[model samples]
Target: MEALVLAWPGGEHAFRLPLAQLELLQGATGCGPEFLLNKLNLGQWAATEPFEIIRAGLMGGGMDAAGAKDVVSRAFDRHP
Candidate 1:
């Protein structure tokens, strides 16, 4: 499933996506934030294979796989 439960409106916060879905997106998304964001944003108008753009953009932005994962992990740790 290419879906994510956005931060809940109020009271409860349930920003979660299935691990399998995330894994699929990870392989497709490469290292950019756009496809991921678009995915989290519902992906209604997203490209068919946005992962290509994600990979290209990540390469252009000079962020490799490890670096991107580090950033995400740090973000979660710092915020939570």
Candidate 2:
């Protein structure tokens, strides 16, 4: 899968959805990859889906668990 690099609050970070992350995401959302993607595309996701996806992707992109969680927390806040 391709990595999604974005300019976050502090700096640019790369996020990815590998198999392991995908599986975790599926479990968290109780949906398959296609369904999840569709939901995201259609803007039908639940409140936590985006956060989960970003956290998982950050981990998949080689960020440590704590770092990923911190980044997701900061990025998902009310700021831009």
Q: Give me the candidate number with maximum TM-score.
A: 2
What tens-digit string does per-residue lDDT give for candidate 2 at 1-80? 67889787888888888999999889988988899999999989999888888888889888998999898888778463
Q: Highest lDDT: give the candidate number.
A: 2
| Cα RMSDs, all models | 13.2, 1.7
Which residue window of length 10 is worst by lDDT in model 1?
8-17
Candidate 2, residue 60: Cα displacement in angstroms equals 0.6
Clash count of each predicted structure: 0, 0
lDDT of 1 by residue, 7-79 (tens): 3222221222344435545676563446567765785534434434333333334446565345444544565
TM-score of each: 0.29, 0.85
Query: Model 1 TM-score?
Result: 0.29
Whole-structure CA lDDT of model 1:
0.43
The alpha-carbon deviation from the true structure for residue 41 of candidate 1, after best TM-score superposition, in angstroms, is 3.6
